[model samples]
Target: MRPRILIVDDEPQIHRFLAPALTAAGYDPLRADDGASGLKGIAVWSPDAVVLDLGLPDMDGKAVLEQARAFYDGPIIILSARDREIEKIDSLDRGANDYVEKPFGVGELLARLRVALRQRQRFPGGETVIRAGGVEIDLERRLVRRDGEIVKVSPREYDLLSRLAQGHGKVLTHKELLVSVWGPAHVHDTQYLRVFIGQLRQKLETDPAHPKLILTEAGVGYRFYSP
Candidate 1:
């Protein structure tokens, strides 16, 4: 599965830029607009990495970072407007994996995130590979192959497929899949799932009209074939 990155900035522009970039780079993007929600996202979601901003409406970003470090061992990259040397030093000392000043380039941010994930060894040991129907998912490598050839999938498609594939045989509820891929804000947006799931079937299923790899559990949700 691709890494899930939680972006804890209140700015809509930041989310717009980062979320797409993160997804295009094969990472799931989740958002929390303020410090409290940010903390909650980190605690509840357990994102693979974080891009946090220092100026939060509810509380200081430093507080969120500190509180997060208390239990969340994953990488946190501070993405704030505060570019002061002291701020960087303090944040790093307080368990931030790295710091990026605001108005930063999307490319640089992605590179930093990549480095943080590498350093943390997000995928530690054995290869995480999943096979269902004709599709082969390599979680650690972030590649989906069909008939021994890589299949290009959108970031959202990858995220949804990854979640379902990770769960293997278990049926994931609509709320669960919606929340994980589109964040809590879109928990009730079941229509989004329907469209994406159909798209996934088209790409992964030899016959989208009658899917075998990704199956629906009637009014419930979806499941990835176990064998």
Candidate 2:
């Protein structure tokens, strides 16, 4: 099946540009001009990935992102005109998997989309589950449990934790985690990592202050070493 990609932007030109590009890249393109309709499309079509624009006529894109995170676990790439550092960080922190500024190259967008899809395909036929220490992560089911108790996490938090877990003790650099979880444009946004890492430690670590599960590499990123 051709992967379905939904483009949620108010600009007609964006649709015109992306629909064809996505089709050329072997994806079924879906479109929505406003946040409400975009959320509806997510529920109805259940696209493999989403390209969201922050500037919506009816609502801010962040609101839509929050609602989508409630149910949708697929990759969501924010396509926004706002190029401010805080805006990108806010979106990534709010559960967006990636962010692209306006006037982005189609090639870059396609590459990012492919990365997202590739990450999704890592768990094939229920073969991708990670168990470390007292934590069990069911990738296919998107469930995380520690010591037989369910550990709830936001979408971004889950993504971050999964990335680290997948590394399997291999140190993932700051740039690597930022780009993989927050997109290439945010490779320099280390603060986003700090905030999310703190959140993850609070939830996953027995003691957030002296973390043991997610070991920090000081200048580098982090490693998930529960054993």
Q: In candidate 2, residue 3 scores what lDDT? A: 99
Which ranges of candidate 2 are over 4 A from the true structure? 124-163, 166-227
* Residue-level lDDT tens digits of model 1 in 1-227: 98899999989999998888889999999999999999999989999989999999999999999999889988788898987766775676576766788778999998877766764463343548876556889898888999889999999999999988765344467777888899999988999999999998888888899988898866657767644
RMSD of each: 17.4, 10.7
Q: Deviation in angstroms for 182 in model 2?
A: 20
Q: Among all windows of ten consecutive residues in candidate 2, which has the lowest summed lDDT? A: 118-127
Model 1 — which ten-residue stretch has the worst lDDT?
A: 118-127
Best by lDDT: 2
Cα shift from native, residue 148, model 1 (Å): 38
Look at candidate 2 and tell me the lDDT of residue 58. 100
**lDDT score, residue 227, model 2?**
58
TM-score of each: 0.54, 0.61
Clash list (residue pairs), candidate 1: 1-139
Error of 1 at 74 (Å): 0.5
